[model samples]
Target: MNLKRINIPSRLKGLCYTLVIIISFNMIAPIAFAETTFEVSAKAAIAIDADTGKIFYEKNANTPLPIASMTKLLTLYLILEAEKNGQISWDEQIEISDHLLKISEDLNLSNVKLVKGSSYSVRDLFNASAIISANAAVTALAERVAGTEKDFIDLMRAKVISWGIEDAYLISTSGINNEDAQGRIYPGSKENEENLMSAKDMALVAQHLLQDFPEFLETTKLPSTVFAAGTDEETVLESSNFMLPGFYYYKEGVDGLKTGTTDLAGASFAGTINKNGLRLITIVMNANDSNGDGGLRFVETTRLMDFVYENWTYETLYPKGSTLPGFNKIDVPNGVDLSVPIITNDPLQLWHRQDMNKEHLTLTMVNSYEALDKNNQLKAPVERGQQVGELQVGYPEDTLGYVDGSKQKTSVPMVTNGATKKANFFVLSSRSIKNFFSTIF
Candidate 1:
């Protein structure tokens, strides 16, 4: 039998080679592709370090989806901020406006009924909103904080923008659909439009709330509280978060975050936990509960959390005194020494996954060299262990990325390990004269 020889096009051959290499790489190191390895059932999901805002895993986290009552998280944030700024006191009494009373009386919505002519303390309204996801309580707080719910919506927009989030669409203080706002919708948003935010945005809001006003957790952890105890309008407010201490889906370290659900936003959760000092925040949106039990979001959150706890650990990625290959030193022109060695000032401790390929990690120098010369060289008289700049630790496959979207990676201080002494006046003069001539030429 005669075998016929065939000629392959160069482009096709190169493509074939690339495919083979990719296949070989995948087979050889499946652990490196951590992003694609795990899966969570949700429209958008994310897991992050609550303290550092370092993202560990995410699925469709950047896409803005209906966040439902999670809108209240922002409302809660503004309320706490107002209290901190002395704009409102926790015990300040707010009268039930007819507009808010109308929403509160709606038995269909999650709310604590407010008597038409009654007043409730800010603490009561905050408790109702945080514990039970009460729409009217949140609306009342919004009105009190900004003099109107619409202005509060504007504040929410401004707050998210200040945090580097641009995709958040706000319409209701309670995260209710605009159509469900009962003629009390935000000015510009169209009717029927629900509040939409990316999972990352929700995480960012939660991070700010937890980091800035940690005391808010005091109310959020409540399993049950009375809205207006010993009063006619009194109602029991039970936390919607099933993962709290007393709930069936309870996880040990879980505490104080928020949960949201609506027709538009199926069931979403922004849950946080601090286990052994390593705090984590996980956001899951649009989770499905086939049996209509509303526990699916919790289940998905648990899965995501378990994945993180099992796979990731708090450890040093790069130790102190270590130097990166390319960014290990800086040229010190006009110095006794031509160059100065640089090393990490502190250990780069981060929540990193186990068995991850270290080859995928990279350290890039942050360009904050104020002391650099015209040629990007450090000026003389460098002190030992002087901070020249920062080195950003990077992982390109992190699809969900940091909560602060503008930052590409977590940064660590990069400092000089050895001092670069200033050169003598004669040498400096010679160098300056040579540079002047070179510039002219």
Candidate 2:
């Protein structure tokens, strides 16, 4: 009665506006984002899966510098390949060549004591090079493979280029060039020259190695294995890398590779680790700045390993026998009803980013069709696990990887079990037996 009838709407409007003020405050409050910072200062390094070559974490991964003895991983890989291909037998005896002897004696950091003219098995040379950064052993193997250490070095350069390792150089196999010795030596002298690699390139090299030489783990993980000490058993070799300490994270399926040092390159390492069917390779290059040797390389490598084990994780993308959407249906020949179910090799999961969702990642298909080839013999849809298509995820650029992508496959014939039989005589009247496929579809 006190307010005029015409003013009632305006008064209510003001009250409504006032009521909304309380809700806006609740809506506009800031969210608390829990983020922790982990700084990466290594020149370049990366961690990745051995099978997929999926990068997990990286810093300066493409920056190629002197990788030190980490290059041995490549040398080792080629040598192993040669053995596998029958080009070189494990028992094939190789003598210490002049150049090899020179590298062995010159690299003061580590040596397998390649006695000139002394014969050793290819296996011995490979073992020495991998177990303890033996320049002599690596050079001996390199020279044997391509006829000279120089040629082997050329192969190394070409391979690095192929592997997308831009920042690395392989002037020496042992990675034993002395940084301090550079000032006094000539341009190409061992003292003046050096090997280079960033953390990322080193990791890639390790990745290639593990993929190429699955057997390398057997030798590198011996914790402490002796090699080629005949007549001088005094020189029992050990893993210069102390990662297998009385108690360490490396013990859990962490296997081999090479370790390196030199005043110029600092300490470098590359190796593989497999746990719970999840395999990954980690490389640390120039992680240690101290040439005098305080073992910071081990300390830092362990830290990187810790970050990987704790902060990062692996997840399957698509499990076998699973049906995917979009790809919910697949194309198969003589597939009953003209449509076959789509299946994947592994369960689809956030392999690279276990913390993210499958819906968010970009999924792409790898096109592989089974048609009549020049000679067709009723191939039963190419082996079951054959790659027909793949699902790849696009991830952020800051991290080293975007790996969860995997191969897709056409489902096995549903009617092979004899399910495609005509349900009724009435069905035969609609179309020819073969046309039934199109009609039902």
Candidate 3:
């Protein structure tokens, strides 16, 4: 074949080339992020509704495993509480302890070298621990809070137990192995012990931290910050959570959470995201990364995110002042009115899956009556908005339940919709006489 070629202007050729490149990129960008089949390789994982404690998904979530730096979340919780309760202040300056200084100087750990006799504010230490996962910075804060790291571990144990986590195995304050603590292990604990918690337990910790301290995201969302800013020892601290904005694995709506890695723990993450007003907390523990890049945790967490957003939606299941079928009105025989209408005190909002049938959701009236007569009727006068009992929303039989492994029901208070004044004495006496005569007949 023979063809004649015509030369084009240089400027026109460059413009054509640019347009082609832009068109090609636009075509490929959407495909790169399109969803595909995904499987989680983590030993344990869980995704939960941050506000409602609803479990959206789980895999081997109850088994205990090492959590690495994710343990700092609990430490941060205590520090915030201490500050709120007047035990500590963000501006309070703490003198560097020799023990923490040595750990800070160790090159093997994640830390910023602390100068002996130097003082740092609580805010700086917190930012370093949170943003950089600096172990010694957190350990210093732990010591300052509880007077000793061992005592802080005790406090951590007590706190988790109070949250209904019975199987937490805590050793060091920073989630490092006891051996890494330089012979400063917790009393009676083995040298190799590292902080171990099931995915559920970690989810509970994340849940509590986010719920109790919504302001925490203010610090966790910072991609980079200067520790000891405007000082001679100023150091830059970058977040280990790559899912935040402006990172390689960045996902929109991902703000504050924690990441962990160790020899025993592989790589793990406790991630949270707020999408369209619905916030979810996810935990992936011991994720295997063949590339050894420690990014598999974020990848697995993204899978959990996909599972939730693709399969579930957050909406109001029931409106306020609505009552369950057949249980709408409670018997109040002796009041001015014979019976009183009852309803939910608030709206019932929860996470729902795409394939889930609304008809399958069941509401059961819990037996928690405050005051009842012999026949189960309200004893007398009932006040408006008085809580009569609880209404529990039941999920499917095969559901995995909550991250905490507690009951799967989403409970709301059932209350009287209006007040019922006591009946007059004459009316009560007449009703009693009529009841007695009818019984005799």
Which candidate leads the pack in TM-score?
Answer: 1
User: Which lDDT values do the candidates have, in the order given?
Assistant: 0.79, 0.57, 0.80
User: What is the C-alpha lDDT profile of model 3 across 1-441, one tens digit per residue?
Assistant: 111111211111111110001112243433222232445778988888887677877878888999999999999999999999999899998888888888888887888778987899999999989888889999989999999998999999999999999999998888887778877888888978899999989999999999899999999999999999889999888899999988999999999799888889988899999886668899999887888988889988887897787887755766778876656887788999988889987776555566655545556565443456556557678898877666656545337677666664565667898788899999999999999999999
lDDT of 1 by residue, 1-441 (tens): 111111211111111110001212344554446544689998899998887777878889889999988888889999999998999998898998887888887777888888877899999999999988989988898888898888898999999999988988887889888777778767767877899999888999999989898888888878898877787877777889888878899988887688888888988888988776677899999998789777989999999988887887766666778986677787788789888898987776544566555566656565443656556667888989787776666554544566787555456677888887799999889888999999999
Per-candidate TM-scores read 0.84, 0.67, 0.80
**Candidate no. 1 TM-score:** 0.84
**How does candidate 3 fare on TM-score?**
0.80
TM-score sort, best first: 1, 3, 2
Candidate 1: residue 3 lDDT (0-100): 15
- By TM-score, the better pick of 2 and 3 is 3
Candidates, ranked, lDDT = 3, 1, 2
